[model samples]
Target: MLLSDARSIGRVALPLYLSMVAVSLGALVNTAALGRYGTEALAAFAVTTAVYFPATAAVAGAVRGVMPFVAAKADDPPELLRVVRNGTWLAVFVGVPAALAVAGAGVIARAGGVPAATVAQLGPFPLLMAAAMLVGGFGSTATSCLVGLGRSKVVMRAGLAGAASTAVLSPLLVWKLGLNGAGIALCTANLVSCLITVSGLRGRLPGRLGRTIHFGQIRELAKVGIPMAGTVLVKFAVLGVLTVAAARVSTTAVAAHNIATGLAGLTFTAAVAIGQAVVPLVSTRTEGVRRAVIAGLTITVATLAAICAVIVLGGAERLFTDDPEVRAAVAGLLALLVVVVLADGLQAVLGFGLAGLKRTTPSFVIFSGCYGVLAVIAVPAAQHGLTGLWAALAAANLAVAVGQGLAFRRASNL
Candidate 1:
């Protein structure tokens, strides 16, 4: 049974992992391009991107919520289209405001302290990135829906196309048009990805050009989506506080933080992809089977975390920086966060499992307590300064994972 479940997870998760890795690299391409332009450009990009994370994550959850629904509707094309179109409408509606909010926030970020010139330079970045990602959101939704339907190949193809385009275009744009030009290039890639995803999804999802978009489905999506939005906001709040604290530590510390975060994000992308695969599977499985499934996923997550720890702790400095102290500090920080990653994997897999069971409210509550509140409280309270921040993250992740794990086990029994 364990072997069977593991095989199933692998079948679903491996392609998802590949796609996520490509997406992470695409982000790196953007970072690399901005870095080549100079520190100011990179700094501007970091601030703006970090600021955008919460909104995007929250809005993106709507799409995440749709995955299992689409997966369950695999045999019913019209149902799939119903979910997809609702997601499309929701993306368009939410994306515009999200862009405006992020743009406004960027303006305030500059007003508050960031540099006048840097702020001016950052002006177009938020909207452009948001717009691009808005398009990417549609593609992501489509891909995720496809994955839910056991169509992982389509997701992988779409992601590879986007990553390839971003890698090629980002540098070219940076060379010709500078940092803002790179943003434009990214937007183009996202639009291309959206097109690819839509094409791939053709004949899979129901509803042709004639079907009117359903307001009721959008409302139903919102019922689930609003809480997820809150969860995203909590995450944003936590990161925002931490980013501010890191900036106060030193500019070098901020840079180190960003590098470590990017590395960690790669791990998370894997977790999310795997967790996404778990959602539909768990939703459809028996309780005993679900427990076994979660166990397998937890082990896989731990293994991946260990691997990430070795790579980052072993040699990330070689790739990311030259400063010995920053290297040491960053390595130690990443090592601590690797434990968090382990816990995060467990939480992620089980969290989505719970969501698949329609038990998302508890998850929202648990995550809020663990990440939102506990994280905020613990990070600043750490005695070791920056290391304290890492400790806080580790504690939060472990706490959340343990809490969720217990809940999942008990719920499965019930």
Candidate 2:
């Protein structure tokens, strides 16, 4: 049964995992491209993305509100189409405002307390990020449709397409247009993913796509997704604070933090992919959900530990930057990241496990209450420099791990 559960989990997770890796690879490639551009540009990319990622993630979380329902309707094409149509509409409704927010991320980031110089250097970056955010939000909705229907290979293909675009475009664009070129690369990649996934989703629909949107289905998806978005918002809000703390230390520290985070994010996606797989499994296979979650946890831990070893021992950090100062600055941050990444992976799976049980409300309550209190420590830690700030982030991620893990127990039981 354990093996079967693991296989089931893997069947669902592998494509999802690869897709996330491809997506993350795009960002890392952009980082490498910008790193060669200059330190100031890299620092601006770091801060702009710090805000951009969280905003897009929040919107993605809200779009995920449709997954459990889509899974429930998987056998019924008409109903599934209804669910997904509403979801895409939901994506459009929320995504527009989120893009606007991303467009002004420099000012918002300034308010969030990143160094003003970093913010000032963010010319044309906010607009580019907003463009990526808008396109990516819709792509996330389409990807969720595939995930719910066990069509994750389509998602993988879309992600590879996006990553390929990034690989080909980032160098050319950055070489020609610098920072704005990076943003254009990201936006174009998202557009490719959006087109491919939406095309895949179309084949599953029994009839022509709707001309009119339905508010009721949108509300239904929002009901599940909103609190989850809140949970994600709170967690990343702490990350944003940590960015401020790093910014306070020095531009070098903030840039290093972004590099470490990019590395960690690549591994963290494995765990999150497991959680995304868990949602439909737990929602459908009531008895097997427990085994699925356990198997996912095991898979996540082993995968991350291996990734940590490979990154640390194999000299992969050089791939992220050509800058010696940035490389040296990032080395210390990597040690601290080993612990933070594992803790984050644990919390992410548990949070997704909760989502599987359709119990996202507790997730929001726990994250908001826990992270809100713990995030304040980042301010004081900034005074002590990079190590102190990372430790504060570790504490916050650890506390969230515990809170969300405990919530999963109670939620799964109920």
Candidate maximizing lDDT = 2
Q: Which digits, one per residue and each the tens of the lDDT, describe model 1 over residues 1-414?
A: 666676676777778788778877887898888888778878888777765666677667766767666666677776767777786777776666776666675776866787787777775777787777577667766776777777777778777888999999998888787778778978887787778778878757555734578898877666655566676688667766776677777777777777777677667766777777776776666655475455557656665766686776478755888888777767767667677677777777777776666566677788898876655564464435677776777788888888887877766777
What range of 10 consecutive residues in model 1 has the weakest lDDT sum?
375-384
lDDT of 2 by residue, 120-216 (tens): 8889878988988988998999888788877889999999999999999999999898888898899899999999998998887787657678888
Could you tell me the TM-score of candidate 1?
0.89
Q: Where in model 1 is the C-alpha error above 4 Å?
A: 123-125, 206-209, 247-256, 286-289, 410-414
Q: TM-scores for all candidates? A: 0.89, 0.86
